[model samples]
Target chain A: MLAFIIRRLAQSVLVMLFVALIAFIVFRYVGDPITAMVGVETRLEDQEIMRERLGLNDPVIVQFLRFIGNAMRGEFGISYRLQQPVTELILSRLPATLELAFASATIALVFGLVLGVYTALRPRSFGSAIIMAASLVGVSLPTFLIGIALIYIFAVELGWFPSFGRGQVVDLGSWRTGLLTESGIRSIILPAITLSLFQLTLIMRLVRAEMLEVLRTEYIRFAKARGLTQRAINFGHALKNTLVPVITITGLQLGSVIAFAIVTETVFQWPGVGSLFIVSVQVVDVPVMAAYLMFIALVFVLINLIVDILYYVVDPRLRVDGGGAGK
Target chain B: MTEPLLSVRNLAVEFPTRHGILTAVQDISFDIMPGEVLGMVGESGAGKSMTGAAIIGLIEPPGRIARGEIWLRDQRIDNLPPEKMRKIRGRHIGMIFQDPLTSLNPLYRISDQLIETIRTHLPVSRDEARKRAVKLLDDVGIPDASRRIDDYPHQFSGGMRQRVVIALALCAGPELVIADEPTTALDVSVQAQIIEVMKELCAEHGAAIMLVTHDMGVIAEAADRVAVMYAGRLAEIGPVRDVIKDARHPYSQGLMGAIPRLGESLERLVHIPGSMPRLNAVPPGCPFNPRCPKVFDKCRTHRPATSEIEPGRRAACWLYPGVTEA
Candidate 1:
């Protein structure tokens, strides 16, 4: 097990390096940071000195190494547009994004599991039919559209929530959160639901398909024959087996939620790092963009590592060293 | 006679599809007396396993007990509420399935699966259940039961896993165990051992077993009585030795004839002509008529009802002197 974990960690490091390489390429090939930083009125000598100080004149390999090293220490140079240290800017906004991602994920997982199991257990029931039909909308609609529709309904039409912005954030040390206050919680409800809808449907469909398949397995039939309560058979045996695949999908989806929540963040004017990335892109803030790329890649690598371990933990068959021996 | 532990009266299982209703088992009746080993033998799709599933109330959806009744002792179990039937399942009529590798939950340890079943049916404490689970495993011939019980299902060899499955079925001391081809998926070398373990364990617990398989050799070795089903109908049922040595029904005779004898130098084994009819295509009269060499004029016109061939034997064939039309 220790070897397995070490192997996985090594893989994660390789993956992070690969992603860092991509970020480096983006930093190298994209519009010049100096051009984005200074106006046309800046003197040529000043630009040359600035480029030398930033080590743009170094060998490509040296510059790439410096980029990786700076990324490791969470030190991305000042954003070309914002003129603030990219790391501090991202860190300040990290809490909001993390909060939104977590809330949406919880909603997605809980509702997804419940609805999936429900629909699977009663595939012919009216409620299940309705849920199955409604899930199509969640699946087909774009995230921005869902966010806008939710804003129009709950925020514009009903006036129950604010149409835009993180409301009434509270600080826990250096971390700021909108989760503590009433307005803050209400403010998150729309964007969270919008962000969660697509994932919720995807997870629901996955769980339902998997749950149905698990129910057909011989073990479930044996469990029924063993006279276990329906609840135990459905949840304990079938659902537990179903979760093996669901965990992998859920983990990947969670990484996507954190990394690609850009559309929902933009639609609701969410003050998360996604919107910050968008603004940085508009102004060609290369440092912030590269940092964002590296951060998202790190999130994916960490999540994939955690998911692989979880898969091993949940499935005992995977743990056995040798293939199954027939009697 | 001592009361039959289980009774099925005119049981018929049906599956309603878009095409039509398919009768998987039709008008079958049988009794399993206390501690008896009754082997149900048939060709593939002959409804042997379907009968077992029906008795346990596990006929999968779209298929159900469309007619008749199943009784465990005096309780009419065929129509009981699902919850009530669930209580009776592990507590009264346990089941072992075809494949051992799939029968046990892969995620759970043997001890957890065994203890859970024990606790589900009996009001024993967790420790007590664990102890019984270990004892059950030991009884089924697993070495180091106490330690092995902690291992997951995949860790054990297939035969050993089947032993675990047998232990599970008998854990709650169910009065009747339905073993649906329990050894079919096992290695041929381990087949006899599994059968022996199942028979011995069921006998030790005084649990009547309905062994469903097409393997006549298994029936000859482990079953006290043998039931022959053809195309969803009972062809013959009698003492195992009597059925194997002197099968009364034509289908049973052909079935027995097909099994090669150790010393016989026959040029070719006897085989019945034509396959068992599909559920939707079974003829109006006797289902076996088209395949039976004994097919006669009367066999084509009407269905024959089950009738006594002797005091303790029955055959649903018109050749039986006392049989009548349904």
Candidate 2:
């Protein structure tokens, strides 16, 4: 088992390297960040100096190799727009974005999983019908539309919060000031709720479908006949086997969660990397945009690696590293 | 004779369809004696398994035991709530299904599954459960029973897994064992091995058994008394020797004729004339009227009750030598 984990971890490194390489290529070749934002008064000489300073004048292959080398050593260089170190900007803004993402996914997972299991248990009852209908509405509406819909009702009509913008994190950064502050937590609710709606639908549907299929299996019948308690049968026997794909859904959806957060933060002005990335894009700050894009992609790669590793913890069958041994 | 252990009287199973309540098992009655092997023989969808599952209170919803009483020893168990019935299921009545490969959980070790059964009703310590698991495995003829207890279901062969299932059923020390086509999923040769092992195990434990199967030869070899089902009703039942050699019901006779003898011509072997009637649209009178060779006007219009043919043998047929005079 340790050998299997080691092999998987090694593969995770290869995936991360491949991802970082693609991000570097796409940041440079796809669109010219130089033309989109620089001032007209900036001299050709000054531009050349900027190019040399950021290493843009270097060979593309050489630049990519250096970037990977630096990343391996934990240096992300400096951001062109903020005139700050890239790692510092990402680290400072990362917590807020991560906070929103984690809260939203957690809410979705707990709520959706419960609703899904409840529906699957009853199958065709009235409660299940309502859950199915709710799931339909949850999935059918696109994320941006849901975000807009929420903004209209919760922010505009209800006037429950500041329309946009995260309240200053400085005061809250200190526990002396931030403890259960009305402004700190209230600011995050709409964004978290907006992000959770879509993931909830995805997770709920997946869990319900997997649970239904597992319930029909002979082992389920055996469990019932084994004198194991009902709680044991449903959760211990049924849900335990259904967890592999739950982890997969959680991991896969984290990417979409971040992506959806981009639009959500843009709409709500949540103090996160998503809104920060958008600003860097509109102004075409090449270094900052490159840093942001690369960071998001790396986050995705790492999440998937974690998910792959967790598959072993969920089902022992996949832990083995060989062909199926016939009894 | 001592009172029979289980008495299922006028048992009928039905499902509510769009048209109406369609009866599946129609007025079947039989008794299971303590320390005896009663073979339940029928074709697929013959209600053999429905009887087994129903007797254990595991019948799926919508399909209910419409009219009947299932007595265990002296207690009527048919109408009890699921929670109440669950206590009796693994404690007093044990079961083994046909698919050994799937009947045990893939996620659990054989020891874990068996230990769970032992601990559910008995408050034995983990060590005691572990010790019992090893003994049960050994009793079922598994080699390296102590070490192999930690092995998963997939780690064993088809026949071996069946033995594990039998061991699990007997782990709780129930008085009656219901082996529902326990060897049907095994190779023909392996099937014989499973039957022999089950017979010895149940006899050793002094537990009566209801062996549900479709194999006539298997019933002949394994059963003490035989209950022959047609569609969903018990058409004929008697001591295994009498049921096979002197079957009174035409349906039972037709079933015996269907099995080809080793020395007999395969081409000349007889087959039942037509399929059993669909549940939703059973024939107006007899459920098997369309296929009964001895069908008469009365047989087509009114169903025959299970009248005793001799002191202990009974069959639901108008043609039983002194049967259905009414």
Candidate 3:
């Protein structure tokens, strides 16, 4: 088991290295950092001095090594647009994006699993048919459009929620969160729903398909014949079998929820890193962009690693070689 | 006369497809006496397994028991609601499915699967269920049952896994167990061992077994009575020895002859010529008529209903004067 975990950790390191390389390449070539860093009034010689001071003249490998070294120390220089250390900038915005991502992901997972299993167990029922048809909207509509429509309905016409921004936030140490406040909770409802819609549908459909498939398996029939209750057969035996693939898909979707928070963040004007990355993009703030890329990659790699571990925990077949084969 | 532990009266299973309703098992009736292993033998599509499924009420949708009555003793189970029938299944009529590799849930430990089923049907504590499960496993010939109980299904080989499956079926000590092709997916060497373990354990538990298989050897060894089905209809049913040695129905005779005898050598094994008819394409009369070597004019025009040919034997064949014309 330890060896398995170590092997997975090694694979994650390689993935992160590749992502780091991509982030470095994107930062290096996308725009002139010096132009963005200085004003139009600055002299060319002064600009050269600043560029030299920043080690811009160094070879690609050296600069890349320097970037990797700095990244390891949790440094990403300064965001040119915000005039703040990129790490600190991201850290400040981290709480918002993380909260939204987690909220939406929780919504997506809980509702998706329940609805998926329900639809699978009662595929012919009227409620299942309606739920299935409604899920198509989630699959078809773009995130931005969903967010906009939600705002128009709940914020503009209904006057039930604020149209944009995190309403009010409380500080828990350095972390700022709207979760504890009423207005803040209300404010998150629209964006979170919009962010969750696409993933929820994907998860629901995948789970329903998987559940249906599992229910038809010989084990399920055997379970039924064993006189297990409908609840035990469906949830205990059938649902547990469906979760291996579901966990893999849900993990990937979770990474995407954070990465794609940009659209929902922009539409709702939520004070999250996605919006920060966008503003940095317009101004060519390479440090923040590179940091954002690295952060997203880290989330994905971490999630993949966690999912791999979960596979070992959930499925005994995978663990037999590592743990049971010895016995 | 001993009361039948299970009785089926005019059971007909049908599948409704786009074209028409196809009868999978038609006019099937039989009785399983208490603690007796009744082997159901047939070809791949002969509806042997379908009969087993119908008794347990596990028939898949669009296909159902269109007309039938299944009685567990005198309980009249066929007409029972699904919930009531479910209660009877594990506690009264347990089932062991084909493919032991797939019958046990791969995600669960053998203990969890066993204990869960035990507690579901029997009033027992977790620890009590665990103890019973281990004992049942040991009875089924799984070595080191207590230690191995915690291991998942994949830890065991095919034969060991089947022993676990047998243990699972008899865990709640049900009166009857429907074993559907239990050894078909196993190694040829392991087949006899599985059958032996199943029969012995079921005997110890006093559980009657409805063994469904096409293997006549298994029936001869383990079954007390044998019922031969041909194309969704019963061709013959009698004591295992009588059916194997002096089969009354032509199809059963052909089936018994097809088995190569140990001492006698032949150029080719006696094989029935035509395949069992598809459910939709079954002819108007006796399902076995076209393939029967003794096909006659009456057989082409009329179906033969199951009727007593001997004091304790039955055959559905036109040649048997006692068989009522359908």
Worst 10 residues of 1 chain B by lDDT: B267-276
Q: lDDT per prediction?
A: 0.92, 0.81, 0.92
CA displacement after TM-score superposition, residue B102 of candidate 2 (Å): 1.5
Instruction: Give the C-alpha miss distance for residue A169 in model 1, angstroms.
Output: 1.6
TM-score of chain A of each: 0.97, 0.89, 0.98
Interface RMSD score of each model: 3.6, 3.2, 1.8
Tell me the spans in candidate 2 whose CA falls farther than 4 Å from its real position.
A148-163, A168-182, A321-327, B265-268
Report backbone clashes per prediction. Answer: 0, 0, 0
Name the regions of candidate 3 deviating beyond 4 angstroms: A321-327
Per-model DockQ against the true two-chain complex: 0.58, 0.48, 0.71
lDDT by residue for model 3 (A1-327), tens = 789889989998898889899999988888789998888999999999988998899999999999999999999897878788999999999999999999999999999999999999999999999999999999999999898899999999999999899988999999999999999999999999999999999999999999999999999999999989999988899999999999999999999999999999999999999999998888889999999999999999999989998998898788857434324
Instruction: Give the TM-score of chain A in candidate 3.
Output: 0.98
What is the DockQ score of candidate 1, to 2 decimals? 0.58
lDDT by residue for model 2 over B70-147, one digit each (tens)? 999989999988787887877888888889988987777788888888898788999999998899899889988888
Model 1: lDDT of residue B46: 93
Q: Where does candidate 1 chain A have its weakest 10-residue lDDT segment? A: A318-327
Tell me which of candidates 1 and 3 scores higher on DockQ: 3
Model 1, TM vs. native: 0.97
Instruction: Score residue A263 of candidate 2 by CA lDDT.
Output: 82
